[model samples]
Target: MRMGGLTVWFWALASASALLLGPVVSSSSTTWVADGTVLELDDSNFESAISSLDLVLVDFHAPWCGHCKRLAPQLDAAAPMLAALKNPIVIAKVNADKYSSLRDKYGVDGFPTLKLFIHGVPQDYKGPRNADLLVRYLKKFAAPDVTVLDSDSAVADFVEAAGTFFPIYIGFGLEESVVSKLALKYKRKAWFSVVKDVSEDVMMLYDFDKVPALVSLHPSYNEQHVFYGPFEEEFLEDFIKQSLLPLAMPINYDTLKSLDDDERKLVLTIVEDEDDEKSKNLIKILKSAASANRDLIFGYVGLKQWEDFADTFGANKKTKLPKMVVWDRTEEYFRVNGSETIGEEDQASQVSQFLEGYKEGRTIKERVGGSLSLTSFISSFLGLGTVYVLVFVVATIILVRKATEEEPLRVGRGDEVDRATSSISEAESREAGEKED
Candidate 1:
C-alpha cells in the first residue's frame, strides 16, 4: 500500500473518534469571588478604616459602562501586587448606584471613579484611567516614601509653575494626536494632553470644547496659544515668533487649490451610508492614501448629499450607488462605479490598485499575482488529509494480515514410528542372513 493511503486511513479514524466524544469531555468554568469578602470598606468602616490603612484605593463603579467592563480585568490583576506592597493598601470597590451616600460623599459623577484617600480624607486625586500618573501620585504622597510630587498637581499650581514662555500644539478631535509634530518642528516647548471623553468636573473647568483648541502647558501662557483646526503652513510660519521651531504642518485645502494643473489630483467619493462597513473601509483607505501623498487630494461626499456631488461631477448614479470621481484642475473628471461593487473580499487590493494607477497619471499593469488562490489552497489541503487516511488504513490491514499468517515452529523427540522402522530393518537383515545360511 502507498504511504499516502495509510496516512489517510489513520487520520480519518482518529478524527471520527474525537468528534464522537468531544462535547462530553470538554468544559469551561468561571469562579465569581464574593465582593464583600475581598473588598473591605463600608460607610461605618470608612472613617476609622481610612486613617489606619496606609493606602486606600476605592473604585466607584456601575453595572453598565463598556469601558468599565474592559478596565475591570486589569484592575483585578493588579490587586495582588498592590496587596503585597510594604504598608500595603486595601483595594475596595463600590457600586455607586447601590451606595448613594458614599457616591454623594465622594462627589462621584463618572461611571468609574478611582479615588485614593489619605488619613480618612480624599487627597488631591486623579484617575479611573491614567494608571501611571495614579501610581506615581500614590507612591509620592500616599506611600511611606515621603517623596514630593511634581510641580503641576492642581490647576492653579500648573498655571503658576508654567511662568511666561511655553510650548503649544493645535489640532482638532483627539488631543492626544500629533499636535506635538508642529510644536517639535518649531522647537517650541509646551505641555500637551488630548481631550477625548471628559468628566462634568473637567468640562466646567475647561469651559468649552473649543475647536482649533490651543493647548499649552508652560509658565508663559500669554505667549503660547494653539488653535486646533485646518491650517496652512504659511499661516503657521507667519504666526511663529521664533525661527528655531521646526514644523510638521499639513497642507490645507487652499494650498492644493493653488497647485498647477499637472501637479493636482482630487478624489471625490460618495458614501451612501456613513455607518456602513464598506463606507468605513473606503474612508480608512482614502485617509491612509491622502496622508502618504500630498499631491493626492481625497474628499468624501456623503450619499446623504448625493444629488449635490453627483450634479457637480456629472456622475452617473443609475448603475452605481457608491461612486468615485477623480479629477485634475479641468472641468472633466475620470469616474468609476462603487469600489468594485461593495461585497468584494479584496476591497483593499482593489483600492490600492486604483490609487496607484491614479497617482502614476496613466493606467498601470496589474501587480497582484494569482499564486494559488484561497479556494485552491483549501482544496489541496483536504486532498492531502484524505490521502493520509487511506494510507493509514492500508498499513493497518497489512500489519494485521502479517500477524495472522505468521508460521509457528514446533519441537519433537524421536517417536514410536521411528523405533518400529529401525526394528523392522534389523529383522529383515536377520531373515536375509538365515536364508543365505
Candidate 2:
C-alpha cells in the first residue's frame, strides 16, 4: 500500500478502538463564585493577585458570551479543588466587557479565554472545561512533571496494564533524569513514568540491563521500542516519533528528501515546540486525518529545528507553531486553514475538505492575511485619531496663552497714549498765553 494509505488505515483503527481517545472529558457542579476558592475580580485585584500568586487560573470572559456563561458554574465548582493543589493555585475571573484593558492586553479575542498565569506569565489553558479535568490540569502545575513508579505493583499497573491501548513511555533505572524533560514534553501525548530507585526483582521483569533506558510500549499498535541513554531531549522526541508513527511517518530531513515525486500531495504541519498544546494536539488530529484520507501524505515539520526546510516555503518566519500546509512537489506550498493554527479541536472536517479540493483538481492557494489587513486598518485609524486629537489640543493651548499675553500688552499701550495726549494739550495752552502778553 502507499504511505498515505498506510497512515490513514493505522489512525482510523487507533481512533475507532479509542486508543486515540476523544479530547473532551466533563463533569457536574453547582453555581458558585470565589467562595474562598475562586476570586471575583475586576481591574483592581487581577494584576496584583496573578503576579503575587505562585500559580493562578484567570477566566477572561464577557457577560454576554454564551460559552463564558456556560463555563462560569463549572469553573466556580472547580475553584476549590484547583486552589487546593500542592502549590495552591488561585482561580480568578475578569469581566472582559467591563475591563477591556485586561482582555486586550492578554490578546483575549474569544469570549471565554482561560489564561493560566504561572509566575506572572499568562498561558492559555487548552484542556477541557469540565471541573474534574480543570482541577487535574491545574494540579499538574503544582506536582512533579514526571511521576516515578516506586513499586513493582505500581510499575506493573501503570506500564503493563496500560496494555497496547495507551502509549506508555517508561524511563527505566538510574533516573537522576536523562529523559524526564522528554517525559514532561510528551505528557499530552503519552503516559510517562520514571523509576530511578527500582528494586532488582522489579527491574528484572522488564529484562533491560541499561542504567538509564527509555522504552515506549503500545499494545493497540503492538509496538515496543527501547533506547539506552545517554538520552537527550532531542533523542527522546525522535524515539517517540519513530514508535507512534508505525504507518504514518514523521517529517524530518531524511523523510523530506524521500517523498516520491508522484501525484501525491504532502500535508505538512509546521510545529515549533513539542511541549506546546497546539503542536501536540495538531499532531494527534493529523493522525486521525491520515486515517481517513489514505491517498494524501500527512506529516509535520518542526519549524524551530528545521530552519532550512521552513525557509524553502517561508514557514520559518511564522511566529506560530502547528500551522498546516499542502505541497504539490512543484517548488511551492499551499497553507491549509482548518481553524487558525491548531486552535480548533475538530480539524478533521476542514482537512478533509482541503483534500477533496485537491482531488477535484481545484487550485488550492496559500491563506493570505485577512488578519494582517484588518490589523493594519485598525492601527492606521487609531494612529490618525491620536494625531488629530494631539494637534487640536496643542492648537487650543497656544491660542489661550496668546490671548492672555496680548491683553496685558494692550493695557500698557493705552496708558502711554493717554500720557502723550495730556502733554500735547499743556504745550498748546503755554503758547497761547505768550501771544496774549
Global local distance difference test of model 2: 0.56
Instruction: Report the lDDT tens digits of candidate 1 across residue range 1-437.
Output: 12333333233233322001111122133222222123645565555445555456777766554445666765665555455444444556777645667766675534466777754566323432444333423433322211122222343343443333333332323443344455444431233334444344543444435554433332321223354434455554434332112111112222222233224456656556545787767777666655455455666655454343344444344535455557553435664433433334665566666666565555322211123222222222222223234444554566456544332111111221222223233334445666679
Show model 2 residue runs off by greater than 4 Å: 1-36, 156-168, 180-192, 197-211, 217-225, 232-234, 240-437
Measured against the true structure, the TM-scores of the candidates, in listed sequence, are 0.26, 0.46
Task: Indicate which candidate wins on TM-score.
Answer: 2
Count of clashing residue pairs in every prediction: 36, 5
Give candidate 1's TM-score. Answer: 0.26
- Candidate 1 residue 181 C-alpha distance from true site, Å: 15
RMSD to true structure for each model, in Å? 29.5, 25.3
Worst 10 residues of 1 by lDDT: 18-27
| Number of the top-ranking candidate, with lDDT as the measure | 2
